[model samples]
Target: MVLVISVTVSFFWLWFIKRFETSTRLTGKPSVIFSLFLCGIGSVFAALFLAELEELLLSHVAFLSPLTYYVFYVGLCEEFGKFLVFYLAASLTDMTKEPKDGLLQAAAVALGFAILENILYSDWGLGILLLRSVMATTGHMSFAVIWGYAAGLYLYSKRAGKNKYSFGMVIGAVCTAAVFHGLYDYFLGMDLKPISFLLDAIVLSISVYILRSLKGRSPYESGDKEAVAEAIESNSNNFHLNRLAGVQALKTRDFETAAKYFKKASTVNHREISTKVCLLFTELLTGSVEEFEAYRTLDRICSSINVSNLNRLRARIAEVFAGCPDEERLLNLIDDLIDETGYRELLKERIAQFDKYANAIAGKGCADSGFLISDKNSLPMAYRHPSFYTKENNE
Candidate 1:
């Protein structure tokens, strides 16, 4: 009976996982295979535990009396064993990049154990097998999920240098698992007594709570890009669209247009130091070095006081352009400026420009026209408009 149940349960769990892993739309073969391998190892260890129950109980200090402690023993041993296997598996494979992947792998391990354990129980027939696959398998999957989530969180926290209290999480997971395992066993050991339903409810609630935490507490929140967009929208009242237009012009290699847009944006208003430096670059590239001196006539034109050497470097690069008409020297200076400050607006502009016109210095290698730029050409018009490009009139 146990044998038949194990075979059926394992097949179903494996099929479920195969679908779930595929549905994620992930392409790598190694992570998928490693997750399955974790499941198989978990099953074998569970079968070994069942085979040597007496020795296991002794090692666990479980005398089958005061059943709470017995459940705790089982929980501790099982949780710790699964942790060891997961750690070893992770060390051996390169598939553990994302947080959600760890939990999936843990579920595989837990399901494997449940399937094997169902097979070993002597009294279980087809009817029992069905119940075990649903109830028992689900229980094991839930338990595994708790630790799998922990593994994900720990890895994420470690990567970020934020989990100084990670050791506590292991203790917390094992103890939580023990509580749920104890409640389930206590009800089952009571042989379906009427009050057992209430205990079962409690167990379900606890399991649900752990699963919810895992779902919500994944290391990398999936919608970060959307979140950033929301923040930008929320602050739209304070954002200057004209300034952004200038940055766009510089990116498309329209230096003359960029100069006009930056001039207008700088004269009207600005705060970001990045905006000031970018405006200077535009002015320099349009062959208007003397205009840089125009800033001395006003108290200030932009909010970000230019960086100490930023203007000097721009001026030096202007001289390089003036001395030999060498675009290479000027471009090198611009690239150096981008690397030193790590400002992404410039890089993002270049990428967007390359994507659009396919003629900018940066756009040389791109092959896809549809991917390059939209037919509307909003970027070009946005930079050239007087409302966006003519700064001195606004000031």
Candidate 2:
């Protein structure tokens, strides 16, 4: 059961990261990935050794304050332990060559530490176990993100013969990670009311944001025209994992998970049209865009003529476009496909091309297209009038 939970939690994150890594220049080599995992496990022992040393020094020496001790010792020790493993991984494998690679490997190492920590804490009870899986694991990974990105940046810049500043940035990043980690644990141990939780939330939120933003800076994100081409170039086994996961979830109509997987795939290659169609299909149909302002994103790409990017999911695309009630304004934009023909003719041709359009909706009612940028785009004035709204704006 312990092994099961560890694999389920850690490997899920690994798979998601692997999907994102598909668009990177790395091969996503399993040798380095699992090697980091094993090193992460071993790092727990390293932390234990460091802790013993810390206790010995604390017993003899005095510290300025409780917070300072935690920051200088507890946080420093734990983070440094992980850093030792990352250093080891870099030395032994070719994995840590890129900044993004550093971030992903950092996650792998953090997961290994989390898994081992989870095993040690399993006797505490299911509640703590579950809580640790999410919060503690996230905290561990979140802290590592800083140092990992820094280390990666150092390697990247050094290789490119660019900035010498990244080396200092790495040291600063590790210190920053240690400070946050120390403060986080210090607050948790102090058990202050909202302060602890608030700080934890801020740290985790910032880490999550950094992870997302770094994806665009990935070297593979050279704005390549083809979606699968990125994966094809990398030749990663995890290529299309997100797309396939989305399809499986879509088959079961598990819109939530399908949305997550498709979103992951899009992060890998935003220009990839197939994932965009499925993601838009699910996000709209589920009304997830209601509060998400997905409309702004939709309008941003209204003039896009990548409809021809549809490849394998022709039947799925047909099914979605034929029946999505939320796409009324999208239909309007489709009708305005200036370079393409009429919506119906396009649908007919699409049907001929993809076996058939599964289900077609012809009801003429104004969909709150602006709910997700339905009418707020620069795709020409083809659908300002509802009568002109075409039904072809679908997956």
Candidate 3:
């Protein structure tokens, strides 16, 4: 009965932490299940190996005090073991993409470790189970968060091309988590009830602080909009930054520059449908049909293009022009979208430009039609319409 309750409670805690993940769509159920299994196995082996080492050291090191052994040796072994599992999980999968994922996965590893530890300590009966459930298990999780936050920052920096900073963060995170874990054990090992309780409170408080801080910094949070925007603006290699810049450039009819940025963004994260679509359009407009064809072969954008869906329409137009297999069907789809959405006039204008550019590319080449302008002054007359591609007056 006690074992059942403990396991159930531990799993509940896992579920609770997972519930707050930033994006379930990004971290699917299968990934979570796999992580839980791997971490659980890792924790069991880590415990067995550490147990042997502990006995060997105790026999040889006569001068070592209980406090010293608990703080340095025991704490280091446990924390380092948990961290290894966490690091492996982070590196092996896309599960650690966001800050919240780092926190959640780190917590998952600690919980898995604690669950086995709890089962072993269960011989002490219900009181031990209750105490371990609330304090010991939670303590492991709390300490893990320090490293988890660092793991998240590392991944974020790596994506943003801050390699040196990310490497430093990884080292710092491991050290911090180990130190905290050691300190927590050292306090409890003292066996002084009042002091131990006070230290527990302090440790718990710090854990809560870390959790709240990571949550606030999550990219998916509405309150962190400014932070996300800042990341996009400042990080040149950042996918969001490149995507936004490409969109702005496209709006101003800078097809060449827009294509360059969108291509970069797509390269960084190919799964992005919008970026793929925009890149295709910009490439086609700039008369890079062969290059565009190669890009399409890299990934098939299967989503339907709706006239009412401005973004998808842009991509569909690019698809139609790029000679997608179902070119006739796509054109019919566009016609239906235009008719249904009452955007006939706008569609007609865009279609006219597309036809003109196509004819020019077939005859004089893409560069002569002004689709691939090498300089601002070389922009074609058709694309220079003030109401359309001209950004100065519009802005």
Candidate 4:
């Protein structure tokens, strides 16, 4: 019953912590589950690590005092152990794909470590259980937030070819967390009634501050434009496979199939522009994305490509506007929304592609959604869009 209650309380707090994080990036829940198991082992490893360090210190470093032992030894060893486990998880997989993921995964590892540590130190009293389980668990998780958020920001902000100062940003977090952990442990160890009372308010305040502060620092929020990532720093194996598949499907005029591949690719690596373009194309053709979204995505992607691809995208956008809206009004909207005058000039090229396609394929609307955009004509700018298709068209 003690163990059950401990786990139940920890679980409730874990969920409570997660409720504060508001990033929309989708990640696999299995990653968190895996971290739980990995960090449970890591807690055992931390115990052994601290034990050896203590013996080593006694033998050689008799100069070090007992008063500061909690800060230097216990805090560093435990934080280092958690860091190793979290690092392995991020490096081995795309566990830290989003900035918010750092917090989530870190919290999982902390909870796992705390739960196991509590289990080992179990006693018969409910007061002891609540103190160890609740206080210890929250402390571990709160300290973890320091490093977790930093690791995530480092991944997001570090451009391709590596940022020289990036290591400091990430490792500094661990050291910071270690110091905080030590101070927290040291304070609690004092056991004075006044100090203990003050520590509770401090812990709750710090946790709330850290969790709330993360909302403003989300990697997706720059310029009010949110994509999966800020930079395409990673080259994913699965992303490459899906990208190739999407390209092939696009060439074959299978827009629906193309979109599926691009969507999967985007999920694998948010930083990749090619995948975003492919997905954007599909959304333009099939999905009911807002007109502003359509214009915003085009403006963002247009300037980054070569003439061939730029013209391809430009011609498609012009064609879609020619078919669906007043070309003159949209031309002005394009000039207003897009930043570059030179880039806007490039989009002005007359390519009446979609109107002809719309005329050619009159009426084959899917019962569920979208029109069949498959081409029977050997058009110059042949490609597939994301959502526009039918059962017959797919066949």
Per residue, candidate 2 scores C-alpha lDDT tens digits across 266-326 of 8887777656867876787677665235544544444344444322234446555554454
Tell how far residue 40 is off in model 2, in angstroms. 0.9
Higher-scoring candidate on lDDT, 2 or 4: 2
**Per-residue lDDT over 163-280 for candidate 4, one digit per residue giving the tens place of the 0 to 100 score:** 5347688788887777777777776777653564465457557756766666555433321212222322442334654565655555556678768878988888887664675577
How do the candidates rank by lDDT, highest first? 2, 3, 4, 1
* Model 4: per-residue Cα lDDT at residue 345: 38
Question: What is candidate 3's CA lDDT for residue 315?
Answer: 57
Residue 343 in candidate 3, Cα distance off native in Å: 13
Q: How far is candidate 4 from the true structure (C-alpha RMSD, Å)?
A: 14.4
Flag regions of model 4 displaced more than 4 Å: 17-34, 63-66, 123-126, 157-165, 193-197, 200-204, 216-223, 226-395
Q: Number of clashes in every candidate structure?
A: 3, 3, 0, 1
Instruction: Tell how far residue 64 is off in model 3, in angstroms.
Output: 2.7
CA lDDT of every candidate: 0.53, 0.64, 0.63, 0.60
* Pairs of colliding residues, candidate 2: 295-372, 295-373, 369-374
Candidate with the greatest lDDT versus the true structure: 2
Candidate 4: clashing pairs of residues: 282-386
Ten residues in sequence with the least summed lDDT for candidate 1: 230-239
For model 1, give the RMSD to the true fold. Answer: 17.6
